[model samples]
Structures are given as structure tokens and as C-alpha cells.
Target chain A: MTGQVRTVDGRVAGRRGQETRQKLLDCLREMLSTSPYRDVKVIDVARMAGTSPATFYQYFPDVEGAVLEIAEEMAKDSDTLKELVAGKSWAGKSGPTTSEELVDGFLAFWRKNDAILRVVTLGAAEGDKRFFKIRMTVLNSVAKPLAEAVKELQAKGQADKSLDPNAVSGALVSLLASAAEHQKAFTSWGVKVKDLKPNLAPLVYLGVTGKKAPK
Target chain B: MTGQVRTVDGRVAGRRGQETRQKLLDCLREMLSTSPYRDVKVIDVARMAGTSPATFYQYFPDVEGAVLEIAEEMAKDSDTLKELVAGKSWAGKSGPTTSEELVDGFLAFWRKNDAILRVVTLGAAEGDKRFFKIRMTVLNSVAKPLAEAVKELQAKGQADKSLDPNAVSGALVSLLASAAEHQKAFTSWGVKVKDLKPNLAPLVYLGVTGKKAPK
Candidate 1:
């Protein structure tokens, strides 16, 4: 478990202090959703949280630091994604279903945290080590177990043996992440929102099983 | 054809004016690769270009506007990506070669323009319509022809009929784009940089043809 929350000045946050800190974080998260990342400011966050800038500073050194905190929390929550693949059947009818659930679950998680994720992704692509690590953590939550599943399928002679299991899983996860991030792009390409999962799940099935999804 | 280049105030730029504008843009592009997008300033870009902020403003309204100019240029260049898939054969050994070349060409394009694409991607993700449009133009350059290829395969009874051609091509293009943008993520997952194309090419082949790549 994470140890006691502390202020920027290094004081351990008491119960009331933790509540205020959480409130500030919640407000910052809300502001990020509505405004461009570059325009978000501490004073606005402080005003929204019914606190002073000094209080905001006590909990976070800056906006980026606070954003990192939210990203870290989201990365931790991504652990649940493992269930979408781990110990799940990728055989026959069960295979396509697993792919569907994985796509649905992954897309839902992305939609829920998209605003924060936009910043995290931008930071990582900009070569920020901290954001890069947080992103890898999130992607690896599913990629690791998915790779194992691909390896199992290959061992059983059910999947392509020539492909690198890690690469296949990594590409699939990257595909899911990209599709989730830019769902609008698909819309403009004439693929409706409802059609996204149906299309994506089959590709996942194809990638993992090296066969078309069963009719 | 696109019309002559004009300044922010609607003046058609003469030869000397165009040279200055191009220099400013080149300097800004260099600055973007070195600095965070949020931290990039007009004064610095102008300073780097050996000009004043007034000269910078003559060509572009602001930093973001200049970025849009660069992104637009890149989007135009992306038209070359269409050749990567247009009229390409997707049968037998030719199919895997096509996939390899497409992946190679796409990744190389992305790596060369990664800095601008990162900002364009971030801006689009944040719901900016202009950036969204530019990003679409770039992706469509490849996705359109790629979708046509998938449709052709499906028509020939080579790919799955249950799948949507547009969706499959969109997803595959999304996968390549994501993988290209986040190659570092794969490296951390234990997939070598050199291994990315070999691993990705087969997935593309499998997705489009609905069969394993031929050895």
C-alpha cells in the first residue's frame, strides 16, 4: 500500500488534509477535461476547489506533478484489465467473445479517463520518462497476459508460430489503444460507433488465433 | 492547386518574405523537437530564426498557428503514403512483401515527422477540430487505399465477409500509427526496435488476408 500522503513541504497529511488534497485533485481532473492542458492554471484549480493557491501548492508542486499523480492512479487501476485476457478461453466461439469483451472493457476504460490520458500520452511521446513508464505500466497490464495466451496458442499449434508472441500482443494492445484514443477518426471514415467493437474484436481474434473469426 | 502563400494579414508573400517565413518555420520545427509544446514561445522561435517577434507574427498569428502550418505541410506530404498500398498485390508471397513495405514506409514517415505528429495527435485528442481534420487527412491518405485493398480481398473470397473493410483497414492503420508513435513502449516490453517491422508486417497480412503469412 502507498504510505501516508504528504504535502509538498514534506508534512504528513492528516485526515482533513487528505480530503482537501483529494478535492484539489478532483477539481484539477475536471478542469483538464474542459480546457486545453496548456491553459490549465493553479489559480483556477484553487478557485474551483474553494481553496487558496497556497493550499494547492502544499499538495502539489505544479500542474504537471498533479497530472502525474492522476496518471499514476489510473495506471494502478489498469490492473483490472488483466481479467479480460488472463485464463480466458481463446478457442472457437469463446475466442471472439473474449476479444469483444476485451475491446469493450478497454475502450470503456479509455473513454472514462481520456482527458488525463491525452496529457499522459502527449508527455510520453514527448519523451518524458515518468509518463513513458506510467504508459508502459498501463499497456503491460494487458499485453503481458495476452502475450502468454498467444504463446499458449502457438504451443498448441493453433496460432502462427513465426510471429513473436510479445510483438503480436503489443501490436494488438497498441491497436486497441489507438482505436480507443481516436474513435472519432473511425466515425469520419464511415464506421459508426456501434460498428467499432464488432470490427475490432474480429481483428483481435485474427491476430491471436491466425484465423478469421468463426461465423 | 493550392494558391500562393500569404501572410497572416492577407498579404501575398514575395520571394524574400517567403524565405523569412520558411526560416522561421524551420527554426520553430527545430525548437519543437527540443522543447515541450507548451513551453515553446514565439520570442524564442523568432530569436532562433534571427528575426524579431514582429516578423514571426507576420507569417503566423501565434505559435499554434505556425504549428498548424507545419502540420498542414506534413499532411500534404502524407499523400505519398497512398502508393504504399494502392494497386499493390495481396496474394501469396507478394502479400507479405506488400505488408512489409507498407509497414516500413509508414513507420519511416512517422519517425521523420514524429514531432509535428505528436502535437497534431494531442491537439486532435483534445477535441480541436482543425488538428482533428489534419490528422484525418494524414491517416486517410493510407487508410483509404488500404481499405480498398481489404475490400478487394473480401470480394475475391480471400478475407472474411463478416468484417467491415473500412473498419479493418482503419484498425490496422491505427495499429501501425500507434506502434510507430510508441516504439519505445514495445522496446520496454522486450520487443527490439528491429523486430517491430517483422512482427507488425505479419499482423497486417493476417488482418487483411485472414490467413497466416506464407513462409
Candidate 2:
């Protein structure tokens, strides 16, 4: 279980203090989604939350700190993504279906948390270790298990033996992450929004099983 | 032709003026590489460029404007990426060679311009149309021709007919982009830096040709 929620000044938050803290986080989340990260400020977040900047600072050190908190929460929720691959069958017709569900599940998780995820991605790309670790947690939620699946199939001679399961699964997950992040790019390329899943799922199936999805 | 280089105030930049503008941009580029985009300021860029904020404004309306300029320059440079796939042979053993070269070329371009591309990606993800368009120009530089190659292979019965050429190529390019952006992530996954190309090239080959890369 998570330890007690504490203010930056080291005071434990009571129920009322916790509600205020959550409200500040929710408001900061909205601010991030609507405005550029560079433009998001503590005063603005405090204003939106109907609290003082002093109160905002009491609970969090800064905007980036609060965003990391939000990212950490989302990373925790990302644990559910494990089910999209864990103990799942990748046999026969089940393979393509598994890929589709994984794609759907992953994309949905990304879309839901895109605002904070964007900041985390930017932070990680900028070489912030905390954000990088959080990103890994989310990606590995699916990737680690998916890589295991690839290894299992390869062991059984159901997949290509030459491929590195970690690389294949990592590439597949990276592909999914990129596709989810830039879905609009596909639209401009003449692929429909609905066409994405149908196309991506097969590629995932192919990448994992090293065979074209059965028609 | 790129037409006349002009200042934000609508004055044409002469040779000397262009040099100053370029210096400012170069300095801003350095600032972006070393600092967080959110924390990068016009004043800091101006200071680093040994110029006044007013002079910096003479060349660019703002930091984002200058960044867009840098991204535009990189987009123009992206034309070279087309050669990686434009007229390359993807037949038999040549298929894997083409894939490896494409991976190498694309990754090199990304690594060289990772700083600017990071801002562009963040801007695009945040729904900025200008940044999105530039990112597209860079990506489409490869995705378009790669798709055409896939189409040709599909037509010749060398690739899976059921898969969409555009989708397959787009996904592959997306994978490369993601992989390039997060090469560090792959390294952390027990994948060595040297292992990326050998691993990714085959995935590209597999995705495009619908078969494992021939040993």
C-alpha cells in the first residue's frame, strides 16, 4: 500500500487535506491537457483549483513534481495492461485476437492518460531519469510479458528462433506507442481511424508469430 | 528556392542579417539540447547568442517560432531519407540489406537531430498543427516511398496481399522513429546499443516482405 500522503513541508494530509491535494492534481491535469506544458504554472493551477499557490506548494514542490505524481498514478494503473497479454493464448485464431486486444488495450490506456504521458515522454526524452523509469514501468507492463510470450513461442518452435524476443516485443511495443501517439499522421497518409486497428493488429501478430495472420 | 529570408518585422535579411539570424538559431539549438524546453527562454537564448532580446525577436517572433524554423530546416534535410527506400531493391537477400540501410540511415538522422525532433514531437503530440505538419513532412519523407515499395512487393506477390501497404510502411517508420527516440529504453531492456540495427532491420524486412529475414 502507498504510504501516507504528505505535504512538501512533511505534514501528513488529513482527509480534507487529501481532497484539496486531489483537487489540485485534477486541476493541474486539466491545465496540462488544455495548454502547452511550458505555459502551465503553479499559480494557474492554484487558481483553477480555488486554492492558493501557497497551498499548491504545500502539497507539491512544483508543476513538474505534480506532473510526476500524476504520471506515477497512471503508471500504477498501467498494471491492468498486463492482463492484455498475461496467460493469453497466441494459438491459431486466438493469436490475431490477442494482438488486437493488446493493441486496443494499450491504445486506450495511452489515450486516457495522453496529457500526463506527453509530459513524461518529453521529460524522459530530455533524459530525466524519474520520468524515464515511469515510462519504462508503463511500457514494460505489456512489453515484459509480451517478450515472454515470444520466447515461449520460439521455444516451442512456433515462432522464428533467430529473432530476439526482447527486441521483437520492444519494437512491437514501440510501434504501438508511436502509432498511438501519432494516429493523425496515419490519417494524413490516407489510412482511416478505424483502419488502424485492423492493420496494426496483423502486424503485431506477424511480428510475434513470424507468420502472416491467418485469413 | 526558399525565397528571401526575412525578419519578423517583414524586412528582408541581407547576408550579414542572415548570419546573425543563423547564429541565434544555432545558439537556441544549443540551449534546447542542454536544457528543458519548458525552461528555455527568449532571454536566455538571446543572452547565449550574445544578442539582445529585441534582435532575437527581429529574427523570430518567439522561441517556438525559432524552433519551428529549425524544424523546417531539418524537414528539408529529411528529403535525403527518401533515397533509403525510393529506388532500393527489396528482392531476396537484397531485402534485408535495404532494411538494414534504411534502419541505419533513419536512426542516424534522428540521432543527429534528436534535440529539435524532441520539441517537434512534443508540439505535435500537444496538437500544434505547425509542428505536426513538420513532423509529417519528415516522416512522410520515408513512409511514402516505403509504402510504395510495399505496394510493389504486394503486387508482385512478394509480400502479403491482405496487408495495407501504407499501414505497414507507416507502422514500420513509426517503429523506427520510436526506436530511435528511445534507444536508451531498448538498452535498458537488456538490448545492447549494437544489437538494435541487427534486430530492427529484420523486423522491417519481416513487416515489408511477410517473411523472416533470410540468414
Candidate 3:
């Protein structure tokens, strides 16, 4: 049975290896809730997960590799996002986007995973190399749909056709990212997230639409 | 004199108090350059500064307070930033903002001070209440001139007159604050700060002129 398991390093394999891997990932997720990747200690994490340090070493070279793997797995499950965007395709393909549709999607995305994002983004900002790489991977995932909308509008001649879609995509990405930040701040100050949409909606709407929100 | 220097707590304020404070700031800043703010510890900072725990306790009520003071003080100095945006004022008014002027000031400012800004802004998302506050104060200070610029544009009717200068100001503030943040990551990657203006100038210019830079 022990021979059946292949060790990435000189550790036991198979079911035992799988268990150790899950244990490390679970411990990592908990730390991700409250701290960035670099700040977490491998020994502390292993101990918390009830694994030995040697066991942890067998699966992951370090904390960053563990986190990057977990985050990538989580982001791969985009059913919720797909469901949200699917119902609202922004006018079957044209003209300025309604403020409600664009703004509401952004607000909902933040509320769903504020803690996870705050942690992952902070980890990526530092030189947690693997974590940083996946962080951009997740960003590009979000940017994909946004790029589609920009392209859709350009095809219909409503969006700025000549603008670099990449640049506009970056602006939209940064805007929503900041909105997530502002929402968190508002929540901290006891203001509700729902309340912020009214203030934040029009800024993005106008920037993208090049006009006022329709009543 | 000692009484005057003492904090509200019973800790004595003397030459030692000042030295302890300076040491913490210096150590924290150095650590933050190579590491994220959330990853740094008060003990690590105190140890590097060669100060005892008792000495650190005598100065700051907590680590956050010490870090806040350093970043806040950095924000207060306008010589560098003033020079950065000074002649770069809105386009219609006159002279093209010299690449030399813009690049020099931006390079000088970040090359010298990015450590603190990185700590202050990046730490905000980590739920550090002190860094969050310092981030806001630093942002507000940077936003002042941009606010003045928006008002000037609105007055000229070059930009949207109906745009709430305050909201536009807030949006603009968030933009640069976010830029400064990405700038830190860019700097860490060996990208030159002087080279950043080629990318940045167009963003600011697009923002003021209501025209996206030619793709």
C-alpha cells in the first residue's frame, strides 16, 4: 500500500499523500481569510492542519505554491459568475450599457468574496511569485468577459471602436476593483454595500457610456 | 521638557522617545520595501531598529500608530509632488508639461518615498485600520491638486460641467492612488519610475482632455 503512493519528495504516498495535501490546502484557506500569502508560516500551517513539517514539504515547496494552487482551483469554478452574466447580455449586442446591469454585477462580485480577494490581491502585490502569477490569471479571467462587452459594443459602434480594448479593459478592471475597496470601507464605517451603488454606478456608467445614465 | 514629550500614557517622553520612534519608522520602511506591510511584524521592526520591546512600547501605543506617522509625514511633504504636478497643470491653459519636468519629479518622488506609500496603500485591503486611515489622508493630500484641476476644467467647460467635481475628484483620487499602488509593483520588478510617465502622462492627459490617448 505504501509502495502504491508516489512521493513528490521522500514522503509516503497515495491516500496518505492526498490527505496531507488536503490538510495543507484547508489550513491555507483559513489563513487566506485573514492574512496575505507571505505572512503565513509553513510550520504553523502544517501544525494547524495536523501534518508534520516533512509531510508539508513533500507536497508543497512553500506556502505560496500551496496558496496559488488553491486560489487557481477556486477561481476555476465560475458558475456563479457565468450565471450572473448570462442572464444579462447587455442588450443582445449594442449601445451604451445600462447602469444597473454593469454596476450591479460589480457590486455583487465584491460582496461574494471580499475576504478572499483582499487576501489574494495583497499576496500578489508582494513577490509571492506563484501567487502573483495566478493573481493575474484570475484578473484576466474577469477581464475576458469585460473585453467581450467592449468588443460587442465596438461591433455595434457604440463603444470607442478605435480605443485599445486592453486599455479600456484595464480601466474597467481598476474601476470595479476600487469599487470593491470602497464597498469594504463603507461597510467598515457601517454604511451598507447596497447604498454605495447609487454613488458608484454612474461613474463607471458614464466613463464607459460617454453619457449620463438613462432614467 | 520630558513632560511635554510624554504621550497621554505614563511613558516618559525624552530623547529616548524620539530615537525609538525614528528607529521604528526606519526599520519598518526598510522591511516594507522588500516585503509587504501586512507581512512585517512589530517585533521584526523593533529588532532591526536595535530597540528593545520596552523602548518600542514607550513610544507607540501600537505598531499601526508608528507606521501611520511615518507615511502621513511622507504625504505632507509637497516639495516633490508639487514639483511633479506643478507645471503639468491642465492642457488648455498653456505650455506642454515638459517630459523632463514630469519625469524628473515623478522619478524623484517614488524613487525616494515608495516604501511608505506601498505600506500605506497596500496595507489598506488587509483590514489594517491604521494603514487604511493613513491611506485616506495621503490620498486626500494627493487629490487636492487634481481636484483643483477638475474644477478648472469644469469651469472651462472642457470636461463635463455637470460632473460633480467632488465625485470626479474622488474618482481621480482613487485612480492615482491605485496607480501609485501598481507603480510600487512595477518599481519592484525593475521598471524605472522615469519611464512610467510615458504610460501615466497619457492617462492623466486623457482624463483632463476628455479624449482617450490615440491608440
Stretches of candidate 1 exceeding 4 Å from the true structure = none
Supply DockQ values for each candidate.
0.89, 0.87, 0.22
Candidate achieving the largest lDDT = 1
Model 2: per-residue Cα lDDT over A1-215, one tens digit each: 78999999898999999999999999999999999998998999999999999999999988889999999999999999999999998999898899999999999999999889999999999999999999999999999999999999999999998879999999999999999998999998999988999989988998999888886
Task: Give the deviation of candidate 1 from the true structure as CA RMSD.
Answer: 1.4
> In lDDT terms, how accurate is model 3?
0.59
* Best TM-score among the predictions, by candidate number: 2
> Candidate 1: which docking quality band?
high
In the range A66-149, model 1's lDDT, one tens digit per residue, is 999999999999999999999999998899899999999999999999999899999999999999999988898999999999
Evaluation by TM-score, superior candidate among 1 and 3 = 1
Output the worst ten-in-a-row residue range by lDDT, candidate 1 chain B. Answer: B206-215
- Candidate 2 chain A has its poorest 10 consecutive residues by lDDT at A206-215
DockQ order of candidates, top first:
1, 2, 3
Kindly report which residue pairs in candidate 1 clash with one another: none
lDDT of 3 by residue, B40-130 (tens): 7778888999877666766777666777777777766743464454445565333135323443454456557766766565567766776
TM-scores for every candidate against the unseen true structure = 0.97, 0.98, 0.68
